[model samples]
Target: MAINYSKLFNRRATPQSQAIPGSGQVRNSAGGYSWEVTDWQRLDRFLILGAEGGTYYIGERDLVKQNHDAIIRCIKENGARVVDRIVEISDSGRAPKNDPAIFALALVTTHGDVAAKTKAFANLSKVCRIGTHLFHFAGYVNAMRGWGRGLRNAVGNWYNAQEPRELALQAIKYQQRDGWSHGDLLRLAHPKEVSREHAAIFRWMLSGQDELGERTVKRKVNCAERTATYAAVGELPALIQAFEQAKAAKGKGEILKLITESNLPREAVPTEWLNDAEVWDALLQKMPMTAMIRNLGKMTSVGLLKPMSAAAKLVVAKLSDQTALKRARVHPMAVLIAEKIYAQGRGDKGSLSWSPVQPIIDALDEAFYATFSNVEPCGKPVLLALDVSGSMGMAKIAGSCLSAREASAAMSLITAATEPDYVIVGFSAAANGHGGQWGGGEPGITPVNISPKMRLAEVVKEIEKIPMGGTDCALPMVWARRQKVNVSGFVTYTDSETWAGNIHPSQALRNYRDQFAADAKAVVVGMTSNDFTIADPKDRGMLDVVGFDTTAPAVIADFIRSD
Candidate 1:
């Protein structure tokens, strides 16, 4: 028996039989053939997923530049569309950070034509929602090119557009960031004062002077100087004034009094006082939903949140509040990070440590799913294939403290909780435990014991216990076919670096389709922007989505259930 040496068998050629426009193939980071998504698709990924912190296979500088170049090309093609996309992502809070959106906006303003620049400038407030954002935008725009008149007015309009009270709060809360301060922006933009309040705020940011000659307004840095005369000052915004009063308050009692009385934000309080349990309890009462979620560990560490304590009850109530989660635009990743960090009872990069409270840990576990948009159950058997390869677990990352490995574990919970029937399996060539070389071995698929009954933090820990090896994303479909498992859909959480296998994932899916579950769909959630995807572009049954996107569950459900 002789095999035909000249004929193709294992690989599927790019379908030239059907002349699909804009269809092209590219080699993945792991030297596997995968479909290349369009530039517009790549731009959405760059804006939402972000290439910051790099990936296991790529360095940060090169990753960022690759995304940057894609965005630049998109800007050149249709700048107004690019601006609209930025506004869409930023305004919806779909991204983990708004830096990518603002940077994209900066590109439009710098290189886009007049209409594009106008659109970018007009939507500046939407993209740069706060002073920190505006400052970062200013720096990116300034670095690319000098600030032209349009840029100055746009920056000035950002300041002018805000209500004086809101602007004052921003000035106090985010006085400086990204090497640009309210004062520096004021000096550079020279924003027109929209009202007397605006004039006072402008003056306050620029100089330590007040609207009237009553007293010197202590610049935020000089917050140590608490003056009694400022209490009588008429023009100071109430929040700003309360922040100063809280800073100047002589004792914990006074600061607590101010926090309760004035509804002062935690940011307004002096850093030294935050170490106090009493101060944290006081701050918790008035903290915004997002702030409360972020400070959960801090509050717990400071002894403010204890089991069955009033603070713990309040925190639990808030964590379980779906309406508040939606209102705060809380992403599932945020809750996952909080759960992982709080469960460990230690901060990853700080001296902070806390004794994990069981109630709070459980609350965070539930809250991670609540942060995502609701999705109807697909009512089908799903195979969740996790890429626990060398690249996926070699480093810890999915933005901030949540590692790709941890994030994929948490992401699977979305399915375990919603879908009635689903199975999770980890695929790696080295996990076989047969002394296979790091990148050389037959792909192994191990059944992962994950269920909604388990805490997400626990699931994360359990998944980490699995040995990792080189990626072979095809293993999901391959395993399903080999084991004759009835699968309605396949969802792979991977970095898309699957090179250890002889067959491509797309071909594996097709082969499985031919046997059973012909209608089966596969969704590949690429955790990193390493550029290639295993899902065939022409195959309507397969999809490629960005990992960590808050709306991913809903999107996945819709796609899987779609006809």
Candidate 2:
């Protein structure tokens, strides 16, 4: 018997404008509401499902155009994929109180050897774990394979976590007290406080265990300690020269050959030397004025450390003996120092302020709308793949505490309406100790964010429902490659955290690019303040990792504008 992906998955398809399986009426910016949607079709434009029936929401033709090449490559390589279409349903009646609903659909091709491909595809359908029926599939065939099932489960758990403000208050109560060692007081604090998974990493850092290896750490420690010592003695430049001389005398045993050869009495040798910690400390008292001046320059040069502003006052006080300077008019040295540190705050804390955060979020949200904005009322279907990994705990920075899935749905629905076909997929690995159970009962995918017809605001509320879990980028990427929808590139909101799965990030990325060859691009957003260290591409491959703004919608907007 031939394997029928669409039939087996319980997926339904429609090429013309239609209502999302369970959504309500869609509303326009002008506040006019309608139930009908239009389609926008372009050459080589494609959309795929991240899940079996989950649909994409691509409302803009320009976005489809930007990623058309990538979509085609995905189709030629992987088959039986999923995609979404955000069908706007509008009516003259007042907006409904309930959120809109989402529907999933899969796009399949009959041209290829369906039986062989289906069999090959079926082998890849390993459920995340036991009791979880959701299966993994090829990227091209079911582009959005992971979205529907994966997201549904994640959002449900998040919604149940109660209010975040309350959670944060609880987190503070359980957090380690100020002076206690991170280990002694907080290793096992609840997951909400220290994050069960991240505690080990935090502990590792506190233990002085630099994962980059001891040699590098030792070198840096030595350099920092030595520099601190020398500056206290007012001989920093001389110390640098001495070190350079030692290096020049490669393989020499001792560092201070010249000082020793003089046969000078130990006491005659100025106590200004920095060999002993006591001597360095004494020097601070003996030559406090000189040390302050010298250290200021070094502090300014090295960007990491912030010397107390009082140091500036010390400089003026010490130099006052040589020249009279008025505090109101400003000193030449002060001007020089100010210029050196000018704009230092530009890329530091100020840059990370709320102003910057808002624009990025606004742009991303706009990208979601712009994607389908250019498309006629009728546009091609799209696939929305959202990451619900453990790192997404910071998904909400403003507004109501909505689940991640809800945020994705709200933005996705708008885009899906741009096209007649689409799909959605949410993904994560089995939780810690859950063994093989990833998609049912405890920790399952549920589209609570979706209503029969969801509005953009309702989508935000739904996003508050996505729970945090493992960060595995491979599953979604692989699925997209196999389910070759005429995908408008896949959009994933994430903090770039990924575990070692069946496929490494490099390998997964390579396989996708090799098979699809520019057919689609993956957009990753940094949801938290955490840094995402993506490994350098092994085979000269390039992918996009965009830090998402305040909302997932803004992330979509950024993706479209970049194209």
Candidate 3:
């Protein structure tokens, strides 16, 4: 597939003045007019390109402020307090135009406006793609989308129990989840689109009977054939065999459909007797089941096949074999209480606790090791610089930074014995706020200097407790070199957002050598969406960076382990 360069470049390119919107100094790039404005212009005609050329109709905003206000209220009410502070005080008119954060919050809450939301998201993706900030937004979008899907699923189940038009929105949601075409599904459910053929099929399939007395069994068989847009006969052979299993056990009437259709009890059929061999024979007569079984056995013997254990077999038996094969089990660590320390604010504590995601921790361990394999563990001191800027406030990130701290500590604990003696230094260029002291006042990048130490948990706890501020990175780079400790390697975690600092990051590293006579090398792990673009021309070492993910402990651990 060719790269979509348009996606990278086709932003509105409408840069707002650096001065606050209502400020007198808010001058245009054109260098003439100074204006005080409350809100940004709401562009009409939100469009998305289809497979063909012309843009498809998406949505329009009546007044940008109305949408913004709706979003603020909805998010506050819904308890999605990710950007609540900024959103709560937003001037609906000014906020939408100035802040993508405000725009995203509002877009999600708007009712009966799927097209608008889609367009807004697409635009947001396009704008962020040019720089490193895209990843941060991407993570948030993914989590929000997942949460929405879950909410819709619950609503659907509820509506199914109580048949009401109030739940009618759920049918659309179900179709979306299934990846059905938007236009096709909408038309299908529309009252005018209900035709004689559709009505007959609906009545027959839904009512458990058809006019021809060719009830459940025959109907399903025919329905499967029609739906079988499957390119190959091998696909869904298990389902075909399931029908035969029902027929072989008793009769090929209503019994077969009940057995084959999803969500039915297993006691309804002879599933035990209908093993893979029997099922294969029943569906694809040409395939030799005995030979296949023998080949499977050979594979198992050679360790090429991961044979399903009896417990796994039982689990698979509950669902279609295909579903069982595709379904992933929760990682063993996900359910266990991790031997790690507690995390501070962000999201429902009920979900973030170690017990809910032990499997993720285990996966992180595996990933961390993989990433860590790249690092050469030496005797020198390892410097770990953390970003604790005001933006690093737990309020902004949805438990991401907290999770990262925990995971990093966990990895450090495991590697403490083998790796270099670790020293953690927390720095923020911002000033302290009402919440707590952070980094800066002028995007003020204040770098808090901490002597390097090996205690990872203690380091994490300290960073979490303190107010995280400005992201000036140059300070830490210079500070570490000044200490003249033979630093083997330095790993810095930051959001890559920067204010005007005296030295560029690369220059700071070079300055360390020239000014301080130090050989400490560094790799940066960017925790935010902002791209911390530090290129190493001298090939001193690689700059390892990654964006935040929900499962960062595992993801970053894997990234570090790979290093």
Candidate 4:
């Protein structure tokens, strides 16, 4: 794919001002911004990109020092108070555990002096749940190069093993089964600590003892070993062949055994394995409809039309069943999957056919509509404000193709649908007087109400129709207060990089509370990883949450109900 220089340049060029002192408005350059970094933003970058030693953007020694200092200051001041936020941000569900683990290792390797690094590592260790899963182990070992001593201590401490031998065995197993690089695994294995049997296996694999080579044999051996726990070594080959045949047949007995006994990695299983009729039938009998819906795209890709079509029929049949709909109503996963399905284009690879049968599309629409039923009706009236600013259109959600603007709209639609007495508005700065051009002159806030009853896709379309300009986050609350709507709560979905308005968002919320319902609360859902936050840290009525988290709606409801 060709690189889009213009888009890359524009993203870097976008200027963001800092509220902190000594960090003036920083224009985008080759490296280093002038603004003071916030803890959230610093940690966000750290988790996403790992440590930079004056190599990438903002990697200069002085700049890195400033970023590190800011983060340390935040930690020292907040202590355990910020621990939950750190864990939450680290587990943002954008990438697997590997990404964050690598970043954590990078922090230990690259940042701060000895004492500072130790403090940072201690803090990270408190939140980092390394070795909890296969990917976590793979990530830690992958990034363990040139840090053998640290790796040894980490495995001992983090894994809570008395001896390094247990850690070596686990590492070798992951390398053999999961296709992790052998060289990295060997470096961490510490030949002195490994048991003779495990060491032999590792050496055999690394030396290419068989024509099929180490990985192939290791996988078969691991599968067989896991399956025949009580069987002797001579029975391994037969056991491996039996396991393979069972997996290919997708027999229920073998499937259960593989999952329970062998603990086969889900990703390692071939798509064809999932395509089997017996497997689909078994899954439908055992798994919930929501889980099936989430995997629909994957099923479609492998041309499992019979199963995919059957699943679609099942979904449609359940749509009219109130009990079934009620069970799936509040879960956001269904809505998320439905939105992606609705947004998928013909050109998109591995997507459902360009013209999928009507029932499949209808099922998606119904699932999305059902999400509204899941929202517990907040008896009190509310106002939802969605930011449709140019900045909001700049980036897609971390792991998804949906842009921030689209996500904001989708979230707004859910809120509007759930609240019976609600007003939904999309806002951006108004055009300047000069031929209705954007920018300059006391720019005013523009807000437009979108119908709550509109379909989600339609709602997004209407939101897109709103003119995109400079962001003024306070405008929506300001508009609600000025209009005297008397809302009981306020919800704004934004990037939280508010700069256009003269008044801050917290101030606007305070003004709205004083003028209307003093007990009213506001929930600011941040859609991007910027440092700026509109919620007042000290205000009990204000709450800041990360967007795309399935639990956010429930959190908002609880906050609104709180005294």
What TM-score, computed on C-alpha atoms, does each candidate reach?
0.90, 0.28, 0.37, 0.62
TM-score of 4: 0.62
Instruction: Name the best candidate (by TM-score).
Output: 1
What is the full ranking by TM-score, best candidate first? 1, 4, 3, 2
Shift of residue 381 alpha carbon in model 4, Å:
2.0
- 367 Cα displacement, candidate 2 (Å): 15
How high a TM-score does candidate 2 get? 0.28
Candidate 1, which ten residues in sequence have the lowest lDDT sum?
Answer: 222-231
Q: Name the weakest run of 10 consecutive residues (lDDT summed) in model 4.
A: 222-231
Q: Candidate 3: global Cα-lDDT? A: 0.33
The numbered model that scores best in lDDT is: 1
Residue lDDT tens for model 4, 28-59: 22211222235755555444322333221233
State in Å the error of residue 10, model 3.
37
2 versus 3: better lDDT goes to: 3
- Candidates' lDDT values, in order? 0.77, 0.32, 0.33, 0.51
Please give, for residues 247-343, the per-residue lDDT of candidate 1 as tens digits: 6688888888888987777877888998999999988886888788788889988888888899999998889888888887787767777777788
